[model samples]
Target: MNHEITELKFSVRFSDCDEYSRLKLSRLFQFTEEAALADAERNGYGLWNMMKAGVGCAITRMKLRLNHFAPLLGENLTVTTWAKENYKDKVIYKDYIIRDGQGNIMVEGTSSWLLVDLKTGKALPPSASPYPIPIIKEEALPEKLDILPIGFFPKKVDQVQGKNTDIDINHHVNHCRYVDWVLDALTKEEMKERGVRSIQLNYIHQVPLHEKVDILRFKDSKHHAVFFGMNAEDMKGNPLKARCHFQARVGFGE
Candidate 1:
């Protein structure tokens, strides 16, 4: 198809940032996902169109790298996304880039998604789409997204419950929502004192509504703390929905 990258513009609000005035990771995901969705809609095959046709897209995996805190609140940022290619039938790969007004790259991401039937929740089998698929060249990650190397540590977790609002068109906890869960699990004092420097996530499974999830914390010498998320099962059990790792510091300026 076309050679243009789908771009979305955003002005960060106070609500979109951490206490340190850095853009929240979840909000960045929202902007990035919206850019991708808008591009799909323009191509006649994005979230809105899929929903209207009783289909849904599920982002199965995503990993993000942040070079610095997102431009401060109220700053304008541009996000661009492109499909990598038609991958294995219903699955496709996509890449995202976030840039500041100065044209510096702020965040880079790569994600994998599968289109599925709404009713069956099964991956749609290979079929020719009525529309032409845009070839999104895969963006190489500086560091690969793999299962976080879980270190042996005593379990110390903060709990959260998935809410109905967490479900998306796919009827599962929205992928980006997990970032909030991880952040919210932190104490207000903790959040006020640090800003996430960089973060990565690898989604393992879709979390269902109202499941009590655990944010398992680990001691990290490199980052402030390490966190692993689990749900989709009873609290005592372990069925991981996603894994996240991040580094935090005092942040740029105040």
Candidate 2:
């Protein structure tokens, strides 16, 4: 009665690609999320179901390893996702993989999520779920590194407000939008010159609609970049004073 793994097929569209025609990293996240949602829905623990039970899921961290170059527009891709059997510290883990039509792996990722009481906004244990969640023993991409911290990155790259379009069913900015905000911190030339090899993000707090956020970036190394999203008004003069919304680290290929 439970589908331990879920797969979805997709075709890269112009909308899903960057100006150079490669698949956008944010779109890749979206595809992965769609597969996860499909799996949950099939298992009877979908968004609405969880909400009706007074709890909702929120992603806490994500790490993705990419191929040498992103997939091109018009390419056919298949995304697969599954929940790991191990649930610890009130957090659930999910794994994802994306392959091209030729079955070449394009991306491998793993994400951590927590369940929250919708009414109180407090984190809940996995046992709070109304349905018996099924899990797969396979680990698509095992997490190893500690999540990136919100360092005091001096360069403030951009500022943005959580728009209506950025809001998701959970009434918070969608995870993919956070991906976009981080990637946007990089210059087009830098992105093209240094193709992304890996991406890691830690979602510390959710931003509601119309909330202003400050985007900061640090080119910490020749092949690495770090970013932080903080409350714009709350930042004051010290980054430490602001509530960090997310932290991201991007590794670039040579």
Candidate 3:
């Protein structure tokens, strides 16, 4: 396996930024995911093709750290992503986001993913003799970290009827759309006026199309809100499918 670093460039769009003129926290993850997908494709390990061969990639967890905020709409940015190592049943990937022309680091993150059998959706064991994993190591976060957490519980459950487009080759909602749901729940005022500094998410369960889902919302603070997604049963009277905690700031200047 090649361990060379792969990089991609993207521009910040009006939709990518919040009212504070910086890229939205969720969109940053989307961009980084895109970069990883593209890199995987270039490496002949694209998710779609992998599924065709009976394997699929699923993100299990992610940790993001924001340094300088890229708050300008239409600003060009570059994302560098590469695989790091293989674990027992999963592989890890790391990414760096930098402002395009100025070459400033805006954010950096690491994600863990497992390869699963498409037919059963169960994790596959790493090959006894798997390919050599990359050795590029980035700085790790400190032990005492201010990792974000989901701040609210979900309520008002609704199921999303699976549509033909709902199923990816991986047989689940496309990853980015999860962010879309969170963004969709936000009002235009929220999207335009709020700033998100950092975020960390753990993908505990997969949501299928046509599954009943519960939407829950609560304000953690004047500037922050929490959202949750769960099955209808849980929405009505159980736990949540997934909980998201968002940290927001107001009146940020680009």
Candidate 4:
């Protein structure tokens, strides 16, 4: 399948807003995904349709930079998405959010996607088949992890069991499951005492099916802690997957 640059427009909904009336951080990713998929469908290569043809698109990693907050109720917001470049095994996709009327930039994000064979659940080379999608030069990715600090420390490690239900059609852990992990890493008392205001995460790598990922947590300061996911190594103690950084806000009675 050929990757192409596509754009989509949507309105900010009441469900999308936070207490401050601004769009929630997590919903930004959801909106981006929706727009990108809509663009693909408009171009005749929707993700599900591609999957039916024996190809599946998988998000391997992502980086999001939130800029100006969008809080206008019923105001249209335009989301533009396109593939920056294509490699033999993966393609990089970029998304930009802007106010529809003024074109003011709201958020910018980039995600890396891999094409895989539906049967084997392994990555397929981009050059393995003729992709109808147009490819552009790859965008430069950030060298450092971008995330804010979350107050509080986890007293225990969280265990996530990847069952069949936890697996998506692509046979990997669902992206939302990562969010579940982040929330689960915190104790109930912590959540009751302090609400999470904002969060940022870089998806470094995919968690494979049936693999047990240990959720590790460490407090960097009084108001900040780092959380990551890791799998057991063969014997040398090398991590099987790349580490991801998660930042959250926690304080006061919500």
Clashing pairs in 2: none
lDDT of each: 0.67, 0.85, 0.59, 0.59
lDDT of 1 by residue, 38-137 (tens): 9888777866666777776667667666776557878889888887766666667788888888898887877767777777867874254444557756
Q: For each predicted model, how many residue pairs clash, with residues at least 3 apart or on different chains?
A: 2, 0, 12, 4
TM-score of each: 0.80, 0.94, 0.71, 0.65
lDDT of 4 by residue, 29-66 (tens): 67777876786677666886787788877676565554
Best-matching candidate per lDDT: 2
RMSD (CA, Å), each prediction: 4.4, 1.7, 5.0, 6.4
TM-score quality measure for candidate 3 = 0.71
- Candidate 2 RMSD to the real structure: 1.7
Count of clashing pairs, candidate 3? 12
Which of 1 and 4 is ahead in TM-score? 1
Window of ten residues with lowest summed lDDT in model 3: 244-253
The digit string of per-residue lDDT tens for model 3 on 42-93 reads 7767766775677767776665666655447877788887766565434555
Q: Which runs of model 3 end up more than 4 angstroms from their true locations?
A: 14-26, 88-91, 128-135, 139-167, 184-194, 217-226, 237-254
